[model samples]
Target: MSDYSSAFTHCETGNLYSLKSLIDHVDAQRLGEIKDKHRASLLHYAARHGQTDILQYLIEHKKMDANLKSENGATAAHDASVCDRLEALEYLFHQTELKSNVRDERGDSPLHLAAWYGSYPSLKFMLEDQRADAHIRSYDGSFPLHYASSHGHSECVKLLLKVAPDTVNGQTIAGLTPLYLACHMNHLEVIKILISRGANIRLKDEDGLNCLHAACRNATTEVVGWLLEKQNANVNDCDYSNYTPLHYAASSQHESLITYLLNRGARIQAASNGNTPLHVAAEYGRNGSCALLIEAGCSPLDQNVQHLKPSDLAQQNGFTDLSNELKLRERSLIHKALPGSNITSVTSVNDSVTQHPKTSVVRLVVRKKNVKRADVSLQVSENEIVNEIRQQSSTPSVENDTNRRRTRPFAQELQAKVLEHEANSRREPNNSDINQNFNSSHDSSQLLHSLNSINQRNQAGKTRAKLPHDVYGPWMKNLDPDTFKEQLNTVHAGLRKVRRNSLVQQEKYNSDDVHVSSAENEYTLVDTSNSENNDNTPVIEESIRGKEFLNNQNKLTSKTESFQSKSGQNTINSGPKHNQFTGDKTNITMPQWQKELIERKKGIKA
Candidate 1:
């Protein structure tokens, strides 16, 4: 005889008449004895079919495994819930043997499937069954509320929250709460509901952006106004790069948002990396934004990292009005703002190299004008470590010692020229030295961020002297690829060590040399002489070393954290997989419905 499950499937799609005629000819006891290879009874197929009448007949007579999902994770309940038959789903929910938390391979329960499909009545009924886990996030890290909020199902959102208000306030893997998603999608009513229920507006997502930022990205002007006004959100709150809304609005060219922000007292002159809005506007060719910033009191000659006024970037990009205005301003202040930092002076210091007689490690030498050095070490503050890293990143160190012998005095001359310009209020050369190879240079933002961290760590108890690349080219002649990798790792590790040390220092001295300073935001590789014996901060240094060793072994021991300055955007696993609800991205945890359906169809064929 055909299997009982196959017979039950025949009964569901209105094939019952054909199956029963055969059943009568066979023994009733024999029919009950039939099973699939794993013992799924005939009734299991009837419930799995999701046809109410057929499922009712099976439950009444056959009493099958109401929750029999295969080795891959489907059950009779999975089908009823997915197919949106509230009556059948409710029946399965009431079954004594059926488990409420039976998860598919992707970890979605019936509630996720029901909520995602806008199966409202079924969803509510499931929740009423006490069988639904509303808090159960799908493999993508979306709870029922997130799914409802993202899809504009206001009624579903309200119900799910009442069932689980915590879900509404909960963040998904992507660091966005239901409130942020609702606002991002411009669901005003839903947002009103969430807010009224006490959703956090100041919540920063996985990217370190808040609801206001999301609203800007979506260009929801009304939402923007509401968040800024209702929540009293800081429109000037900086993101991962210390960029305020004005920075983004200027970049995005949202005239209304720009205008609104201006009226509300947003600082048009707020600079990230010392770049005024006018400078940023010029970088992206934002002519309108430029005019707005100019009209709103943005400084025409605000100095950028290159020490060039906003006009410099404008002219570089061929912004005529901006350049002309800057030029006019330049003529007016030629005596006060002329570029004459071309004079390089090489300091011929005769200090003893007692620290590392054989190696030239870049050491921190903090001296302010004439003040005696303080004994503050790595136990310094986070701000100090961050600043020190920035300064040291400029110093050159390397396995290549002779490269310095060839380039030394000249590099020192450039430093002197820079200092001279700083002292005289004159501009230094905006471009890097054309003649120097600039070994151990930090050009990219990623490298600069790493270097920035090292500066902060410099104040910390000194770490094991890192393998500095003050001289990479001339010294090693033929550097080992392995050692080269190790040195690179060490550089990053050393940077972390420096930051960790300084983070522990006196917060009062944190800003002493916070070298948030950069050149055109470009960091040229530097050379330094090894001097003092190095200090060790085991936790900080070991973390870097261990990470590097894992990277060398071709296995990621852990993702390197990337805290963007003025923002905590470290690529840390602030992902959903870590804390379930507080990380970034929905972290789609389970398979999609279509794939599951396809697999089910394939199994029938098999």
Candidate 2:
């Protein structure tokens, strides 16, 4: 048996003498019994290596079966055709009773293998001389043209298309055509050949994914650009799940392809399950894609159908830095959206206060220079001013009695200053007693100086206040009664809505078991645990850490269930599978046919 194995090796090297010497040691019947790991006989090896003389001697003298199949059902002719061994193939077909169209275990005939291996000479000879059936489908329901196109064998593809032109658009079991395969593999010339021969670019697969979707999924930038620019393929074409080419590009994490698609009018906000490209990028933890989408004006606050934002997705996926960046951008956008005047300076009112070291005195100074009225300088505590406004508005106080007593003196002093100014202004300007009273004492002298300064400021032209009037305004004077009521209602409604959302979030955090909604279950991967801190907010564990926790929980739950069931009672499982909470939906939840198609595009055997 060992000697017979060496005969197979000799057949491959075309060493006829060694092969014959080995065959003499073994009985002739033993030759038929020996095969390699793939069940390939000496004739299969000889034909694969183009050893025509050895093939002839094995067939004519040794009476080896030319049509004998290996484990994969491939005969000597199939082997020869795949290796481009035209001479061996010619001898086997002409001198023996072998057939050209005999299929292997995968239902692939010699013509399919020849086309798949890019054996241009063997494929041409088989098609021109042997009249091989080009229309025959493999087990995958793909014709020879599909194999040639997918492998980027332009010559073989051209030959197959010329013989059977109708097969150019023929699809496999997955609904993938020759043009779609060519685009997926980025075979530009083959794609061009197929299109010129009337291949439809608009054709989609069973999942409703078009050639553009296939190209973007593989990050075939050139093919994508050509399809969009040359063929006019729809950049916003949606799949069965409503995923556009932009969504596929984002999932691929190819920044350049995403940018190119965007420039070609790919909709950045195109939604799948209400998730835009930014959401997909965030879920996959694709930092570059997220940045690109953000730069292209995608809002981080855009929520999916599950009410999950991009930042939420990023945080769930353990991209802490990316999540924080998205949150910061969201804040900046909201700040910009607010109606406000261009501020000269933004200083906190509390920062302006100074306390004396030797005395119990605090000085609070607020000066506004560009006001429509006189430039005012006030020396009063900010707390006292707030209290005064609150008192005037009749608003309920939340401050302690001690704090109220502390602010009373400062508020009284502010009111006294205002009252004095009003009284002095009411006096007749030409009265001699009033003039004397102002000039008699040092206090009068100080008061006269302040009046002169106020008069000078009044002579200067008035300027509008720098503060935004839209937000802090005299609403009763500026707006009609109906408009004022409407604006007030809007503000109250917004506050109520915010309150509701915060309550919902709090509830979700406090609960021991968090069950995701059906729409969100497909995408949520966060393992939220209640924090020990006083805030009561949930701490989101990283995805990897979450998976470990879920795995431990699952193991414990399974053991408990087995024990309970062994005691003659049925146990209801309470833990979800590790896969349920983890894995990217774009890749993990994709259909099996699409996965196989992707594998084929990457030149991987399915």
Candidate 3:
């Protein structure tokens, strides 16, 4: 049995003498019993290896089953088509009763196998001579065209499309159209051929992703550029997760792709996890990408859903160097904005300038100074205060320049007064001198208080009003709770009133008696005679239908008259307006113009 099966392998290589000797040794009755583990007979091998003479000898002379199927339900014809055995296929079609359209377990016909393998000759023969079904869908709902396009078989694709152009947009079970598969496989030529044949570029797969998304996934620059530039694909197109091409490019760490998408206006801020392109770069430890994104104006302070900034994410992911660099960049930008605001830098005693980390930040420090209790407090003179006030008021009224210059002198005068008081206290340190200084200081203190009061009032008038209790400022111990409570209560009351009214209306409507008309179930019968036939039958007037019916009648008449004049017909064909209808049927002939208008209204409704 093993020798007989081995002889079939020889038959696949077109060795006729070995195949005949093995058959004779095995006896002709046992010849048909020769099969591999997959149950494929000698005919399957012969067709697969393009052994035309061996195939004919097995089927015609040895009486082999030409239509014998393999474990996958593939016939010798399918193998012949896949292996490009055109001569064997022709022999099978002409000499045997084999079915060409038989599908394997995958539901693919011989045509699909030929197209998948890019066997141009087999595919052409099957399509032109055998007339094999080109539109047969596989188990995955993929047509023969999908296989050819996805595998980059340009010739097979062109031939299949030429046979059946309508299958260009045929989708697989995964919702992958031929164009999308081509892009996924990076078959640039197949993509062009499919698109040229009217394949829909905007078709989204089951994942809600387009061809551009597939191209971006594979980082195929040519496919992506063609889709964007030639196909007019949306640069900012998103997937099911709202991820744009820039997100994919960033994740792939392709600098060129990232730059290409960014330059073409791919949004860098589109985030799936609240992380921008910059965050993705940092999370993946893509240092080059991080720098590129930062230079492209991606916000550094963008926080992910976890409230972690890009730098924090980098540090958490073990990219400490990148994290530190990002922190330094942020600090540098802040420092440049404000030259130096209450900040000072100090180097460590043991640290050298070259060895110092540029990431070190300058901090502000405040130290309290010890003050001596003088026997007398310093006071500004009344004449000096008055002179300073007069000079400030007499300063030029040009603008802020004059106001700034005028205020500078007052500050200088105050400094001078303090210095003079310190000198006097040092020069004379006697009890008698202390008493005299105390009295003079008392007079100066009063004048200084008056000048300071004047300055506060002037400054307050020119400054913008501050909030009552600013959160960004130092703690102020005074706040009125009653005023805040009053405003909050007013807003709450207004909201409550609106909500109550809505609830009340809802309750009223729910409790009210609602009437439903049964007009469709009843018929209106009118009597055309002046005399009543039956006393039991109540007479209903036309006015019961009210102003709406009258308006409609007037509109109909006017339209009919206008249409008549337009068609050069003076006579009116509106049959009759019956006052009462006696039967179930109301016969009123509407004009052509009326019918046309009604049709136009119907079309608008549809």
Candidate 4:
């Protein structure tokens, strides 16, 4: 048997003598059975490595098949074209009957492989001498120009475009033209050749991404500049998702490309889903891109459809430091936009504010026409704004008061006031007087009077009823003594049961050392003091106590009648005791239950 591995190695390395010796010992049937791991015959290796003498020996002496295919369906000619072996390819085409346009398993022809690998010699030879079809489409519907342009082979691309000129703008199955591929791969030379040969630069892919959009993926700034300046590609052209090249550059974190795009008039505020390029940079955690965009005047305050600002999105995506920096930038911008604050330069505001063991006073000089020059020193920390600071002047004027009020942090207070004013302005005409009078030129005192009147009307409307005393009065007056005593006994028994439960719970809590949270204690108090209790626990207890007092009053009236029927002398002797009893009873004129219930109601309201 022939050593097929050794024979294949000798053929590949141009060891013609060893390959001939191995092949001469084997018969034609055994030579036919000699194959490598990829099922490639000896002729495939000899032709692939430009071993012309080994090729003649394998074909003429051993009668090896020149058209044998490997597992990938690559023949000797396909292998020769892949490695750019012009001699091996010519020998295979001329000496044998191997065709030049044979395809591989992927349907890539010899010309396609030659152009794909930038094999200029083999590619020219295949086009000029062998007459290989340069317009052959691969399984992916890609022509030779597509491969040459994509791989950055300018010469190969020129040859293919010259031979098949109509294929310059020819698209693949994915709608990718030769120019799109060249720009996407950052092939400057190939892009020039394709463009000079009338290749369409504006063709988009199936994803609606144009050449400019694709160039921003890998971010070739030169190619992007050429596409914008020379080719006049639209910088603000949106893809299917409305993503411009700036959005792609931001996503890739290409700072230079982003800056170049911005200089080329790319819209900084171009949004998709209400998210601008700044939001996209923050979302992908591109800190440099985010800073560049913000410095280019892209507002970090621009919100998405979900109403999330760039800082909010950054925080949601776990970029805490970036989110905080964005917040600082937003504050700086807001401070700059505040009107009439005389903030000439706030660039050092963030830097000047620092942490100190003792509070640092920031002296701010206010300059206004015909107003007293007051130097207000405010104590502020990092990112903390003082909302209000009272200014005590030796001679307090109205202008000083106004200027002092304006010296407070205008960003937070004025922004909230502006938003509230806008909301009030948008209210319907039938809204309350506050909303209706918001834009009116009414004086402060008039507005105060209107507010006071409205409050008085509301308080009058919400006046509590008089506890239904009249309805219970007639019923209490008609109550007999026996029924009143039964109700009083029932109320005492209920109070005893409640007291016992409270004591038991207190003892259980003490013994178990169970510490109730403030919220739980509050909930228990609310539950016991609920006014809507169907059992009317507190109401029944108060009613029974009041009924007992009424019964005592009736007994006192009967005692007075008995005293009238007695002698004047006995009445005079008991006058002092009677006067003391009456004085004590006068202190309890209002029922104890009603007074206690009114105090409890006041405590609950408090």
Candidate 5:
């Protein structure tokens, strides 16, 4: 047995006669019992080092178990495959009965090892001759396809998928499919092969991230383009947290990728946790990415869920230069748009910081302009004035109350002056004759629409003037009776037409023209309950049925309520509340024994 250890040296060096001589001296029963530090026998070493003759001698004459597993469950075939020993692998397959599918300690079969180690010759031999299971999953639930695809062995992946096409979409324990692993490793060729073989590109991993998301995170620009152009991937597709690939690209500081996605219509404002790609860039100190995003019109004042702007994020994360740059860009945009418009001079950030101690935190300074009411041109279009008013009125706060009150009297004075000017212009006989001479029905309609729009704008301003502390009430208190009557009639007619059209479309059953039934075209209400609505017919049917059921239930309840109201006038002093339908409410107050007897009697009524 002591001399048998010397046979391993001979076996390792491929000294056939020296190994044979040494093995012959040992006892025949003890010949196969040899192992090294890794618990691998001489046969394992022979297979690993491509000593085919030694393998033949040990397995044939010494009668060693060719399928004997090492401490890691690796058979001689696994060792041969891992070491790329083509001759030893073939000899083991043809001359011995070694199980090629035997798993090692990591649960990797010989085929898995062959694919992982890039043993092209050994892998082909095992797949072609040994008939290895290409779809066998390792302990981590990774198939041989995963191993081949992960290692960028395109030919090995093709061979595996050729034998087992189903493994192309096989997932690992982490729910990563072969395509995901290929994209994760940036193996474009492997990914292309997998896609051509029907790999699902849209498959998301356990993290709800797709291959494009992975590619962007790993900065694989070519893979990103392939997925976008070839696969028609949704550029704006969001993960579970509503994070687009642009967010990942920006956070990872992939500036070129961010530009590419933005050109392809990736939403620059798409956010997760209210943090845009710009916010993510600022938070992660991606200054270059921040510059690109800012140049693309991303607003610096947009706040996250925490109500912190991107500049605030940069400031909090110790990026003072970036925060200052963002503030400069914001101020530059504002000043460029409003040059010489009585706005405050856009002060340099350094000056502001030195002049005002409060500017240390980069507080937003909203300076009021000194433009007088007379500065507003009367030639401004009505729509422009209305839009300006809406912009001013939309944000209502207690701090702006005094400013709003001051502007209100100025607005009324301007309106009165405009009316006086219009009245004086109308008194001129030349202007009156010109208006009457050139006005067509179209011109008259246009003038009426403008007047109506002005009236509506006035009403909206009045509504917005309500104080927050004031109690809300009916807004139509000052409405004219005739005008209110006309509006009510118009609303009633519209509802009646809707009900009539709903009934006609359902009962007529004109399949050729479901929407337009040789009568009139109008907007139809859609039913939300009909999940399988292929066309307008099912929707119409479901909507009509739902409305009719509601109507009948309402009528029944109204009738019951009317009866209860009338009967309650006489029964105000009755013993108990009465049932609306049966007039029997005292049964609830019946004694327990009497109730049981009554129930038994009712049950015996056969």
Candidate 6:
């Protein structure tokens, strides 16, 4: 018995060539020289491997088994036919005598497996050799044409039909003709070839689907168009899926296909499962397809089987703009006039600088029109708009100008104030003072410290610190909570009512807690007062005779009540033996009559 695993390993590893040579080199004779694939002969390996040189050598130089069937029941010709190896296949086909029928494991002849792997060259070679089987069906009743058609092999389909046109409309195991599978698999070329070979385009399978209908339902746009226009297939055909070609195109979100099909006589209003093209688009949020459908004059007002319109479907899909736009098409204006309220006239006085990476911010700076005010000034970047504003204004002074500019005390004060603000912002504030000048044209500097610093920076290193992320001062956690609480206080008065109501609800709960505490305190207070009264007012009165009498009475009453309760409970628990000790062996013994009776009873039993 041969070791199958070892032999298979040898065959795959090409070790068989070497190991067999060694075995024969020992004068192992013809037995060792002759070799085969574990499950197949040399010709089978030759055909499958496509080694034309080796196969030629094997045939011409070394005469071995040609029609030898291995353990798999596969002939060399079958392997040659299954794999598309033209030269080896040709050699094998020529070597064997012409045979129209030879079945493999699947009961498929070499021709059927050739068709299955779409080995076009091999199939053609087999056909040319007149060795190809056309009418012979496999175990599943699938002829060569069926496999070729099912796989969308166009050239092979053409050749099969050319050799055996009678099998063009042949039905397979599923009762489906070759044309049906071709069209369903979107094999446009195969469909064309089959149609040219007199294949029926109207034949349906178990699904009541003709070629055209399946093509459309599967979003096989090219196939559908080919079937309908080229082959003049039926346009109005439907399937058991209850869907027309138009329903498929829209449902598949194939906008271009839908448009083409619709133009090519596919029904635009055609419905399936109660949804029109527009309804399907809206429900599924196929925005591009929906737009295309609407543009194609599909009405948004069309209803589904559920009686819901496309616009309603759009609203359900959160198509807010589309829904509103559709409604706006029918809208009429109600009012035209607009009203306005209090507006402040603001005139900036200083050359301010502001800079931001994403947007421009206005910074305020106040300076005397004539002299360089030392009042706190900041540096910022210039945006185009602020530059235009500066260009239209007077010449700006440098913040570093010391002697050429007379510094005012007011300017110093301004700079200090600005520094204080920036410092609070966690940004470093300049302690330098501004020139003092109330009469100078620099009164608005305080308001524009951040804004004025916007466009002009004497030093290019500073960046504008904005909003909450500003880093001027050290953060105080206590201040942060109070500030946020104050912010809540500044919330709109209407929300204040809600806040107050929430506070009141919380207060009610607190009030309940207070009531509980107060009740407990009151009870405690009463008990404490009674205890104090008992201690202070005394069990005995201050009168000498009354004190003595009252003390003796209280003691006597306390002892008498306790004794009575205990004695009553003991009597209640005891039966007739009230004074007898039940288990006190030191104090009592069993009754003499009972003991004697026990002894007499025991003696009789024993």
- Give the TM-scores of the predictions, in the order they appear: 0.40, 0.53, 0.51, 0.52, 0.51, 0.40
- As for candidate 3, its clashing pairs are 526-581
Off by over 4 Å in 2: 1-3, 306-606
| Position 358, candidate 5: lDDT | 33
lDDT of 1 by residue, 172-201 (tens): 777878888877777888888888888888
Off by over 4 Å in 4: 1-3, 27-41, 269-275, 282-285, 299-606
Per-residue lDDT of 446 in model 1: 36
Task: Mark the regions of model 6 whose C-alpha exceeds 4 Å error after superposition.
Answer: 1-16, 22-46, 52-78, 86-107, 128-130, 150-154, 185-187, 217-223, 251-253, 268-287, 290-606
The TM-score between candidate 5 and the true structure equals: 0.51
Q: Model 6: number of clashes?
A: 38
Worst 10 residues of 1 by lDDT: 534-543
Identify the runs in model 1 with alpha carbons over 4 angstroms from their true place.
1-50, 53-83, 94-98, 138-142, 250-254, 269-606
Q: Which structure is stronger by TM-score: 4 or 6?
A: 4
Whichever of 2 and 4 has more lDDT, that candidate is 2
RMSD of each: 37.5, 34.5, 33.0, 21.9, 25.1, 30.3
lDDT per residue as tens, model 3, 287-363: 99888888998866555555566776777777767877776665565444444343345222233522333433332
Residue-level lDDT tens digits of model 2 in 1-606: 564667777988999988887785655467777888888888889999999999888888888778788998999999998889999989988998888878898999989999999999999888889998899899999999999999999999888888999998898999999999988888999999999999999898999988999898884688888888899888889999889999988888679999898888877654546688999888888899998998997877566656667777776777766767776776565445432424334322122211111222223444444443221222232334545555654544657556557555754555566567657745533333443333333354455555544445445634323456666666656787899899888976675554444333323322333332124322233222333552644323223343454364443332223222524543334322212322222111222232344445546432
Quote model 6's TM-score: 0.40
Q: Score candidate 1 by lDDT.
A: 0.59
Model 3 misplaced stretches (Cα beyond 4 Å): 25-40, 278-291, 298-606
Per-residue lDDT over 1-606 for candidate 6, one digit per residue giving the tens place of the 0 to 100 score:
153234333433445465355433333234223445455644566567676655554555555555566666677677777778777767765664525367766687778878878998888877877656688988777889988887878888888888888998887666688988787677777877888889887777776767776676564567776667677876767777566766656767567777788787766653444567777666666677777776776655444545455655666667645545443321211010111212232212111211111223233433434445332122121223345454444444465355225334544656667666555534221222212221121334543563455333323435654655334444433467778677556654445444334333322321211100122212111111133355542121112343453354243222222222343343111212122222111121122332345456547766
- Prediction 4 global C-alpha lDDT: 0.69
